[model samples]
Every structure is written in C-alpha cells, then in structure tokens.
Target: MKAAAETMPTLRAKHVTPHAFRHATAVHLISAGVDVTVIRSWLGHVSLDTTNHYARANLETKRKALEKVTAPTTPGGQPSWKRNASVLAWLDTL
Candidate 1:
C-alpha cells in the first residue's frame, strides 16, 4: 500500500486499515459465491456466526436471496402478499 502511495501520489493509504481490507475481502468473497465456512477458516474465525455477519453485510447478496423466494404475481398483476398487511408485517420481522 505504501509503495503504491509513493508512486501514485493520488493514492490515499492513511484512511485504509488492515480491518478495512479484511472486511472488503470478506464482502468480495461472499459476493462471488464462496462458502461461508471457507471464509471463516481463511479469516481464522472460531465461529461460523462471525463469518455470517460478513455475509449479512452484503446487501446485494441479500437482495438476490430475496428475489429467489419472491411471491409470484397473481391474475391482477400484483403479488398477493402485497395486498396482505399481515404478510408484509411478518416479512418485516425477518
């Protein structure tokens, strides 16, 4: 990082930390479909729960997962869940 900063004065290394790099790497790997257990092992995390936190941080992944289970549209051209307040409320609990 320092070497790049020296050659490219525009490179800002001051704001970057090892933790930031680790977080970025975790997010990237999660987005790329790597298994959480592998990431946990690579990061030396003792628990899968800790690595899951990184997985949860990827909004794109969350969105993709949501898209997979999305309710199908009804004959009215809207998902039935959209008309059910209780269903919406239940979904919010997730």
Candidate 2:
C-alpha cells in the first residue's frame, strides 16, 4: 500500500479494499453484457440471487431493453406471426 501510494498520490487518501475492487469488477462485467450466471460462477457465489445484487440495470441498460421490446419484429409494421394463421391461432390459444 505504501509503495503504491508513493507513485500515485490520489490513492493515498482513498480507503480502497480488495472487496471494493471485487465489487467494481462485478459491476464492470455486468455493464459489458456478461451473463449474471457466469458472474456468479466467477465470483464463487452459491446463489444467483447474490449475483443479482450486482446486476441492477442502469438507465442505459433499461433503455436498451425497452428499445428491444418496442422495436419492429419485421421490416414492415406487421408482425410475422400475423401472416401465419396457425401461429396466430396457437398464440390465441394461450
């Protein structure tokens, strides 16, 4: 810690720890579109719920998901399923 502080003065006053580094790494991985299950395995967490703690989506992530939901399924405004009567009937059964 002393040697690192000598070269980088900014870190000298900050209280950084191994756990802080681990948390930051997790958040970065999540932001990079890595799967949460993969992150859980890498972090050695036993539960997916624990990993979900680090998977909270930021505004950008939420916006991307919303865009996917609102985006057209086909180049035309109509959905592909609407063109297929059997598929539409199957969906209606649900």
Candidate 3:
C-alpha cells in the first residue's frame, strides 16, 4: 500500500477492495447483456434477490428502452393526451 501510494498520490489502499472490484465486474457484465442468473453464479450470491440490487438502469439502458417504444396516435391529427380535455386541464394546473 505504501509503495502504490508513493507513485500515485491519488491511489488509496482503503478506497479499493475486493468487493468494489466485484461491483465493477457485475456492472461490466450487466452492460454486456449478461443474464442475472449468470451474474449471480459468477458472484457466488446465494439468492437472486442479492443479485437484483445491482441491476440498476443507466442512461444508455433507458435510451435503448425508449427506442423500442412505438409513438401513440389517435384517430385525429393530435395525440390522445391533447384530445382529452381532462388531461389538458391537468397539464394547465402543472
């Protein structure tokens, strides 16, 4: 720890641990589309619930999910939200 800190002042032995590295590995595997079950086993977690906490949504995942959505259309030229008077009133209140 002393030798590593001497070369790089920013490097702290206490800041990095095996569990932190495990978290990095889990995030990387998740970003690469690895299954939750697979990750659970790789991390040797006893329960699927423990593995689920790591499955957080980031900006990239949200953008990809949005890309799959089909825009809603009403019979008229305007969208359903615009056509509904109640919705328009609610928006005005906001």
Residue-pair clashes per prediction, in order, are 0, 0, 0
Provide the lowest-lDDT 10-residue window in model 3: 9-18
What TM-score do all the candidates reach, one by one?
Answer: 0.56, 0.59, 0.60
Per residue, candidate 3 scores C-alpha lDDT tens digits across 20-65 of 8899889878867899999999999999999988788778777878
Off by over 4 Å in 1: 2-14, 66-94
Looking at model 2, residue 56 earns an lDDT score of 94
RMSD of 2: 6.3
lDDT of 3 at 88: 98
lDDT tens digits by residue: candidate 2, 1-94: 7889999989889999999999989988998899999999999999999999999988877887887786545756678778889998999999
Candidate 3 Cα errors over 4 Å, as ranges: 1-14, 73-94
Query: Model 1: how far is 37 from its true place, Å?
Result: 0.7
TM-score of 3: 0.60
Instruction: Give the Cα RMSD of candidate 3.
Output: 5.1
**Residue 46 of candidate 3: its Cα lDDT?**
100
Give the candidate order by descending lDDT. 2, 1, 3
- Judged by lDDT against the true structure, how good is candidate 3? 0.86
* Candidate 2 regions with alpha-carbon error over 4 angstroms: 1-8, 63-94
